[model samples]
Target: MLSRDRKWFLVIGIICAMIMTSISAWQPQTANAASPSASKVDAVLVVDVSNSMNTSDPGKIGNEAMKMFIDMLSTQNDKVGIVAYTDVVQREKALLNITSEADKQELKAFIDGLNRGAYTDTSVGVKEAIRILQDGKTAGHAPMIVMLADGNNDFNKTTGRTESQSEQDMAKAVAEAKNSGVPIYTIGLNADGKLNKNKLADIAQQTSGKSFITSSADDLPNILSEIFASNLKLKVVPLQSITANGNYQDVTVTVPNDSVLEANISIMSSKPVDARLIDPSGNTKPIPSSDVLLSKSKSYSLIKLLKPVAGDWKLQVKGVRQDQIDINLVFNYDLELKLDAPPAQSYKKGDSVQIRSYLTSNNQQFQDQELYANMNAVLKVKDLDSGTTNEVSLTNAGDAFTGSYTIPDEHDYELSVRAEEKSFYRETQPITISAKAGAGSGTNTGTTQTAAPAEKSNLLPLILAGLGLLVLLIAAFFIWKAVKKANRGFVGQIVLEIRDENTGEKTYPQYKKLNTFRGKFNLHQLLQLAPEFSGTDKVVFTPANQDRIMVRSTPEITIEKSGRAVDTGSGLELKNGDRLTIPLASVDKTILLEFISVNS
Candidate 1:
């Protein structure tokens, strides 16, 4: 039993002790919950060993940057390998199964030993890197390629090939890597801005990777660290396989709205196959190949489309026999937001500026669907100098959202828009607003008008002259039409007959009046009208004023003129009685085109 004031103090002290104990118990739990689990990654470093790198990077900047990249990886679990290439490719280090401190030292030592070689063979390096990753990839590991190049593909001289040929080889390698679901990060160390930056950027874009161009070797370490620290992941869909039972197969895939779609098809058989894509709009386009850096392997074909329309896409495959094929379709849908405002270059203080934002979910405009109501949109304006920030909710404006902000002072401001709901989040690029103008200064009011009075004058002579010229033109058109009709009635005609290679069955012949066919005519279009060209890719025929017709096939197909194989790029001229043959893998008989002339 104590006094009244002492008793009250004792109770208060007990309550405070309980609160402190509760906080102490919760702190560790909160921190543990906030920490994210480490992700497993398999990365390959493809370094250029061309002779130019010796003079351009005598300090071995690439080696130092690579060592830094290796150290930046999370020690929890990430594997890495190294590939060095000049005129040939060599594996400097095998895949480090476990990323430990010891493994890092081993990889660094290998990088340090790299030296400049004869010429640059970028394709070999990329291909080797991809191969190593493919062999080392595990169930939960994501594969990545970090390529450093100081020059273009210059190894063709050693291989006895042209520069263009080497470029084609590199493109093929890139396509293969992309088809296999490996993203390539390209670094162009062009100190003089002479390297092919466009090509490097194209490779990265095709595979959903990034490109960095650095002018100084000193920046390599930081750049490499930044790239590695980024939690970039290539999200891919599950693989789908289909078996063809006939000469041709048509498969349709539904492309989601606002997504980047990549389709890879691999045919099991060794026979060459022709493939094409028909988009939702029913337009036919050839699949991009190694020449475009969209595909690498001959047996596998790759096609990529960004923000593809939401509809069915058709993939048409033509092969000689029924073959087992595998198709992998990968999609990445990220939120995209765009901000539109009056140019911020000149704005007066206290001016009210209207900011509008267009929000897209995975590249698709928001519609009145199941997910639209759950989205939350907000606009933020920050004063860079003062570090003051203001966030405002946006109102729905049908196709987009609308918001307003008044310029506060004469300081440069940064503007950004964010829209998020649940797992979906997207932010626009930060826009910089220049310093505001002084008070009472001229600002863009966007309100001005001008008008001119009408003038009247007489034009009877001008009207007569115009009518006379029209009349003369009409007369000349009639005379030309008469002459053309006369020539068509008497000119010679050429007959093109199509016969099945195995069946010897001939379809109805197409007759072209020689005088009327004196210009270029697309044979592909003509063949489409006939049943015999059901599986043909493309064909073109140009009938000259001279008594000969030039014929060419699509890049994918091979054509023979009078039993001699002709390069697809070069056209062959055929006179009367000359024959053209197109061999088919699936069909028993070759397609024979016989030309005959008949006088009208």
Candidate 2:
């Protein structure tokens, strides 16, 4: 009915209208897809019930506080489990397996009925907690462990093992928790002089958890309330390297409004830098040296903020000394890649090295989604020296991605892990291997030549030489006696006999010179001078006087002076045969520092 040009125009108009309608219909679906659902939290409460707790927790205040904490877990989909530990660990409730509020009363009743035991083995409790969480972890739930301890670990007493052995066991367990991606929240109650706040804090920080120290038992309820009500969420930003240009390097993060944000800037270098936080309002707050909490091994530093102002927050780092310093900026989020290699990084030729990689996101094991047919999820290892690459296929091994490779030759290799459809990439430091020692060649047996006959009798010369040797010995003895007396007059040196806790094998004795006995010296600083002391923090040595030393420790640590536990605030006077036993958290054996008189 219309002309040719009008007909064409009408058809084009209809097509345009249809296209607009289609887009309008897709807009809401797109937005809904982008919105994230609320995440559920699964928590485990590890309570200490050692004999000391009976007195420290008078009137069962701890029990009451825990009951109150359980009551506060009435959120929509919160799940919790209870674990009690003394000489052994026991799971009081398995409610963490499901998201339910029906068992809340039962969990509370169990806490109220907990009794004290003979000794405290914190490691066992933590391990049990990890096992439960790992077995029951689901997609939408985040796993966490909350440990409450009132005294030091006394598991060694029950097992008849050395304190160092117990500490090593505990350290291993904590490492396991870290690898499993479980955040550990440690609470030191009535710890004023009893609990080791530093150790507890270290455990928490390593797993992106928090440490709380409260002198009053009554405050536990309030603290627990705040921890739950805040609903902490983490957002991580990976920064591989930051060069020291003597200028302020800025890292910006957009934080949600009215949220508590703690920024942990881990600088993996020996050089220390000046760090500060800049708010969107342009207000700068410098992180002071005193405020920076150094890890036991001095490997990392953490700075916490209670309630951070919302908006763009910038972390400025200045005065970096290294050329290319490795830095990691962890925001509300915590993510870590646990790489396991042989204890000895260097391996012999023809040896196979098993490399394991575990990736944890927000304290939950991350599994790659099958979004594509060809996932390309592989852990790639390359021989840097030989320029050969090996792509090892990684299967989801429950908590980690694992693969193994045999070294083709003696060369250095680097590792890079790719997973989650290549969305995650982690490049690790290089590892080197050396050629194995070959068999020794047959020993040569050269012809033995007869010695020439001794010159005819030199009796007169021999007699004269003997007289000179006697005179020298007489003079040397007198000089040594005088030197010994001088050394005894002042504490010339202290001998530390380092031993392996696991094997009970003693290494060479380490010596430290005390130029003056009156001056104050930190035992921690002195121990750092020894290579064996590397990666060991929480070494407490307080010298009360020239003759006496005070060994003070927090929960899970014991310093034996002359085979006896040193009382807090008391000093052990150095007697002629006295020895100080220091338990290290990093190794298996206790360090016995014997006061050896130079004269003796």
Candidate 3:
């Protein structure tokens, strides 16, 4: 009996050895079928088992769903494995490859043994799982990493390293997997104890997987099924179709990027469907080396948004599609552009002013559908001088177009606007706008405006005689005893020698002159000075006779003008030691000289 038992044991051992060898060299290959998948898929589930999960609802749901999923995959399998994470990989084990019945039973044992743990280091767990998938010699298989966490990645930073270092290390591991075309599926269990929908969405989106914000434990199974099936099958909705040899139109394809996996959908057009693709950066790319044949039934079309940086992109399709697509394809797209005008400006009654407008595009470039559109845009100005209207063009720059108009003596104005491109279709609709006459009333136009009869000169001009009043208000203070003043320069000039009653001075009129290099001096500006300081309402200077000062200067000077003066009569002047307070003051050194017409 002992001999017989030994003989039987040796036979069983031999059989077991054979099985192990085959699995270790599984060399799993894709099975050829009628409808074959693009690649062989191998997925891993990295589950969280932290203490918080003990009290969280998602954890409970995750646990239950995983139990059932493990059983299902264990029996009907593909290349699958599981990793439970918590403070570290908590399963007392690493990875379970259940390719055969014996292995399936062992997996069941492992799952049954995973009791809840105390804490979680999601980052570490994830990093470990990724390492396994990356290390295993399972070439040709489309690899996937599914990691679940109940909260933020709060793993302790590596000792002696900066936070950035830790992040880099974590990122390094992820990058390695990505470089190998291994997509990581992130499942955020959330702190809400339920699933955090928004956070879950980000995880699913980032990893090319699926996300679920469950309200209860029951919803987990359905969500898990969905995530797994995301890769198994893709549902495409034909929102709209384009002409035969043309590009796709607003094809908003939604394939979960959580796995870092993307697919290319194609349509063949019967003719040259020229495709112009525009990215978020306003960059344009025409599909290279490929052309659409003008065959009514044999055109090929495809759009692949690969190496896709995460974000919404606008794809402008041009050309045609083959009739086999069963699409109601429209051959064109609208080219819509927009113009943004600045805030409105206005002027006082009777003031005519010049205004400006700017332009930009609402849609990038020109849409094929709108190719035949008329190149005209409408710019309507309200409260403007009647008969002021302009027709702009979208074919031109919207911003730099600068549409200018006049606001004539109007208190205010409104600007109405819309860009119109009429062709096969109304490229874009019009938008109403309002601007209050941007600029109005030119310089001095306001200063010289009609003023109500000057308040009856409260003080009459003094007619006192016997002092040949040398009121000598030398407008230009710098003195040059009249050696020259041309047009006013001294080729030869005359002056009346007068006297001052107060000081019995001016005995000899101190002639103020210009030390100029005598020529046809078109010197528009001269003597620019300011006291270095000023007040909003402080009196600057007052001339003796006139109500206000007369600022004079030549025209056509490239440089800016400066300084101001006023009548010093009534003791109201800017001169030092004068007790009288001046009337008004301004900081801006600009003063306008007006031609007081003799008719006035």
Candidate 4:
């Protein structure tokens, strides 16, 4: 039996443990904490396929723009879907996770095969796109919907859907998208001078997206480029216009920094032009090679270079003699903005706090002065009690953006930072601060004094409840420890082989020894050894019993065994000598894992 002192000490220890556990459980997971290199996006393209589009867009430039958008996406694990709608949904393609060149080709083929239909319902297209995102979007991915329309609602009475009904539906869908934090970008073609610009602008504004109006379908590609850049927080830089003389013309494009994941060089011309790239090392890189991908349409040529070296690279373009060619480069950087903590730990009404924000990429500060020249930063503050938000501009002060915000009222407030340019925007996660009542607010000393006795009386029940929870936690800890020990003998190594589904080529078998790891073993830890498997960081394995291991994976990873799809949601079990094939839906590769047991 323990003495009174020891009993009190044990009780204090349990209480501290309970408090720590509760704090851990209550803290929210934030996207800002993640490395910018792991950025992933899920997008849906909603196209208007009404027959009227044929008159507004005689050259089918909208289709070409859609294809260009697809080519612009260079990151792995980015998923895209399509919805072509008129009076009803005429054609729909579910979100296809981009894994390889083959998947991109599949999407382009779908766009090329689009057929126009009679009647128009803008709401139908937006609604379908939102539904697809809601159903297929992955966690931690930025979601967006791009709707290209040529006309407003012209509902057909035969379909029994009225114009008023369409408007109602559109409003409902827009509200749903805004609530879910999904932005809807709208592009209106005013070739006929009849495009409903007001409607498009309203939708974009309400959903925190941008609106574009083009008088000529020829401008579709550039507008789409802006939309893509803005949605992904990238910047578009234009190069000097060139007059191609039917020969290779030297044009210089400077990659700003190492943070750029992809540099998309878009050449806009009336006809297709040939392009060649010479990297900073003076090596002539092959077009459509492993590092370079080129997509050409009737009006534009787009070249995407993956992880281009940070320096001046020369691009040579050959076009028809005396033809005018416009060049633009969009840089997709893996970057995030970080807002510094307040100088003071606590605050009261009328207290002023200085705000400092900086940009980061790959967990390192980015202070490229040239890039900062074209950007603007702002501080966004929200009053938690009133649910109102205000933005204050932050001036560039050398390496960081600086501003100040004064506590206006006694309430909890959230502060964040945003950096933007004409073509792109990026924001940081918000930090909350509480401002309490101060001297001028009111008299509160007597109220606080009267509540002390009631607060003391409530302490006993809270302590008793904590003690009960501590007892249960102790029992659970011992049970978990016992189970962990019992499964310790099931040590094994996994034989892994990577296969490209498109090429039908298999890599040599590799071995990863799963030694003693507490709780669960993460397969992503082993996959991280290879740069190609960078996006799959959530797959985990746990020991189920002495002879079997439980497999837990993200939805993007499709598992199969014995020619049947394994229900990963219900918990997949892998026994000794079991062979499993896991196909990552985001990339064009499959992993083959064979568990081989070894004695401990």
Candidate 5:
């Protein structure tokens, strides 16, 4: 019973709301977004599974150390892939994006399943690792390869490969890795005194990586820790060493600032140790709770705490009497170093370009004055043509560190800024800036430069943006309808396994056939198959195009596939053979699903 004008107004309001929603969807997320993404790491663990390792690592301690390395990865986006090789590639696992505890467990399981081959050829391992990184590397993630071998090359005479030929192949592979900016950290085990130390050192030096030779297999965890920290621009801080008297001993660890995103406290001991952690608030926190993970091996225990409070925390540990316990702390910070681009794209010789570097946390300016009190910053300039490098010191300038570099010559140069403190450091991505011949003396060095005034705003762009937003809204509506129509047909059955984490009880495998169901299949319907999944009735699965199923889950529920977290907010598609692990946090239960054969 509304009037015509009132109805028109209502229509206009609806249109405005749709346009606003479209604009919001397209806008970039701000600093307040949940858990801002950290700089990612893509690493390939290349271990030699040669028979010689049997004599060198009889305890198979290397596998345990590698597992610790996998557990030390603290971020959701960090990826790890495993490569085992001898004379040939014995096994290879693709880069697995670490998103949940399941992914870490999967990686550790792969390491455990490694079997030794009869011969050793380090080249095959290195090359296979490089290939995996080159193929599966995520853009913007720092790529690295850690190779562990006894530094021997033994090919069967019947295979028709010689040591000289193998050396040539290794040289080529190293060059390819170096050109691709992948550093190869080499670990040479010399337990048998036959390790070719020079060979490993040469490969490391050529790729700007580090080389370590350990006489004892037990020293692996520390070496791996060092390499991990060094690659991530972090430092390993050794805490106090203590002797266990069969009673609980207290150790204090200091987290310097709030910028630290993760702090992994590694306790090394020969004997098993039990640890209890006390937060700054004097509350005893659970060791294996969400946001805190404790990984224990035969030789060491790693407690990884996400977003640790910035204060003194205490760790109480009980170990065997007279056992020496060594503790180390590695911090992964969200802090980033930003180098502002120069005023001009190209400059002439003798013209000084001002370098401005600042630190950011969670994608905003980090205004912690105390953190910058003793921090030192430097500008690194590398000559692209001549291959020479030089560093220039920068002085603190309130919010940013400022320095000036006069274009010394007419060659193109790559520049990066590095800021460091006692605890951690950050370096900016290198940028190339060019300078042309002919200029005056470098008199503008260390001088202030004024910024140009902003121009007047225009209305045309705003009007076009509004029209674009409307078009986007209309297109999105149609796309939604299309997707809904595509997900209508019956798919197949899903074999389900439900586990109650609270009681550590699991239900037997159950099957839910989907041939009778049409339209979207939701968890409410799925619950009939498993009475134990009491509270997961909100998750929905729609049959997507091409025999796939699209998933939509409540925000509180976490969904992981093969080791990667599925962004259920945007929707995720699953095909046949896909396995999904859904953790119903509200009910303290988990559901595992396997997409089996499709119905005809």
Candidate 6:
């Protein structure tokens, strides 16, 4: 009976050991427990059907290139839609739809059958794209617009319309999208190779987007890829600040996040310098800060629920790595943010005004980040006139940034972009764009306005004239005195002489009395222009080459000094007569000298 009981005990012990081993092996990763959430990306593709695209004869063939790009998109796993436009806008049968085996097959067929012929109505196409997107029921990531075209806008020409008119229509579409938060990308195909580059480029840049020119169909994809690269967003945010006794602090970091993001999140930065945070117990503890992935490169913070319950803390990130390596940034942004609308505000031509505030932000993680930060939008605008403002980001350091505005047309407008969060930053300079034009009738009856500022004008000639008049009066007086003093032939000398102490010689030279001297002169007493001298120890001169009359307590007639110099930030500056004067006792020559203007 005792032997049987011992056997049972050993068997139970073995069973318990096996269970413990299995539990340890299956433990979850605690390090990734708290991480930031990811968001979405919305991209819209707009293709051109202008007459130029119809000709595929090898001379800058963008017509076929558009189809090629569409083919590439057919392969991408991005949320996209398509639009085609000529004098008016149109969408294919499978326009905005979910990407699926059947959907993609249809998309492929549509692209393959595309033919270019109608005039390019760039603005109208953008309008239709925005409308389709805004009205769509499915909400995902930020919305973006991409367009490819090669021709002057004929929408305005055929309708007897102006860019201002187009802008008005575009403005409506853009406004809807802005409320949605969309960014746009534009490609101008100058097949004739002579499109208005400056105008088209400005339109693209205004959207915080880039414009690419492809002379061949094959190179279009490469250019589009570059635009994709620009879509990447990067930022560094202090996760949480904490305080502890004796100045120790805690901090967490939030890196840039993306929508439908891909690629490993990485950083080249100085190692975390004792980053810490305060716990609920009021004790300071270190917070891990390093070159670690936030949401595995998908979200802003690696840790989702980082809260500093106690103290004061700060975070730091250098642009480069320790050992001073160039920062390597590689990541993709998930795009999705509601575009509210394009700027609907307008002003008179040459009036200083601002468009409107626009923004985008992280939607999935917005619940927490909304209280602290956000992002700015990119745009594409056409028909800007005088005093046009270029689109610029107010802050790249953090997500909250502002945008600039410009004046171009007096009508409806269109702006396209990828969707994003747009916010105003206190430190970021305020976006202000305004223009002042003559109060006259012209095409631009519309303008954006701001507070009035003084105009700049040239006044150089007026200043010079004032100076010349004064100089003439002084010269005429001197000439009259010379005439009264002596006969015309003898009056020519007007006697000017100097005494030399070293050689004890008096030299007198014949001089010509001035007929006239002109221009404004400085006031006799009001203006005293003398410069202070410093670092003069370098000055030195040979005594044998000097005269004693030029010195104190000596019979000198010339005050020649050494070659000391002074330094200013720009370089040494000198005046003809700058000195510390000393009185002279006597002179060898007792001849009378004339004062026909000492400066003369």
Clashes of each: 8, 11, 60, 2, 0, 98
Q: Write the per-residue lDDT of candidate 4 for residues 463-520, one digit (tens) a residue.
A: 5667778878767755776776665533566778789999998775565667756567
Better TM-score candidate (4, 6): 4
Ranking by TM-score: 5, 4, 1, 2, 6, 3
Residue 502 error for model 2, in Å? 47
lDDT of 5 by residue, 411-446 (tens): 888888888876677888777777855432223343
Per-prediction CA RMSD (Å): 27.8, 33.4, 41.1, 13.3, 10.8, 38.4
Off-target runs (Cα >4 Å) in candidate 5 are: 1-39, 438-600
The lDDT values for all models are 0.59, 0.55, 0.39, 0.77, 0.77, 0.38
Where's the lowest-lDDT run of ten residues in candidate 3? 591-600
Q: Model 3: residues >4 Å from true position, as ranges?
A: 1-40, 57-59, 74-77, 92-95, 100-102, 153-166, 190-203, 233-600
Write the residue-wise lDDT of candidate 6 on 1-600 in tens digits: 225666466445544444444444333222112112122234566777666554422342443444333332322243455667766644332123434334444454545545555555567777777765554424434467777765366654546877677767666765555565666666766655656566556555556667777654434434644554443232222133222232333233222332213222122212222223333345444433331213211101122112222222233332212222111222333332332332323245443332233233333323224422554444434333433333433332233223444445453333333323321111111221222333333223242221112111123333344445545644664576466434321101122233454565544332333222111111111112212211121122111111110112112222232333222222221221122211133433222222121111
Give the Cα RMSD of candidate 3.
41.1
Q: Of models 1 and 3, which has the larger lDDT?
A: 1
Give model 6's TM-score versus the native structure.
0.32
**Residue 42 Cα positional deviation in candidate 6, in Å, after optimal superposition:** 2.2
Can you tell me which runs of candidate 1 are displaced by over 4 Å? 1-37, 156-158, 232-600
Off by over 4 Å in 4: 1-23, 26-39, 154-156, 215-217, 343-345, 366-376, 383-398, 402-404, 408-411, 420-425, 438-600
Off by more than 4 A, model 2: 1-39, 97-101, 156-158, 229-600
Which model is ahead, 3 or 5, in terms of lDDT?
5
Models 1 onward score TM values of 0.34, 0.34, 0.31, 0.66, 0.69, 0.32
lDDT of 2: 0.55
Order of candidate numbers by lDDT, starting with the best? 5, 4, 1, 2, 3, 6
Q: Looking at model 6, which ten-residue stretch has the lowest summed lDDT?
A: 542-551
What's the CA error at residue 272 for candidate 3, in Å? 63
Report the CA-based lDDT of candidate 6 relative to the real structure.
0.38
TM-score of 4: 0.66
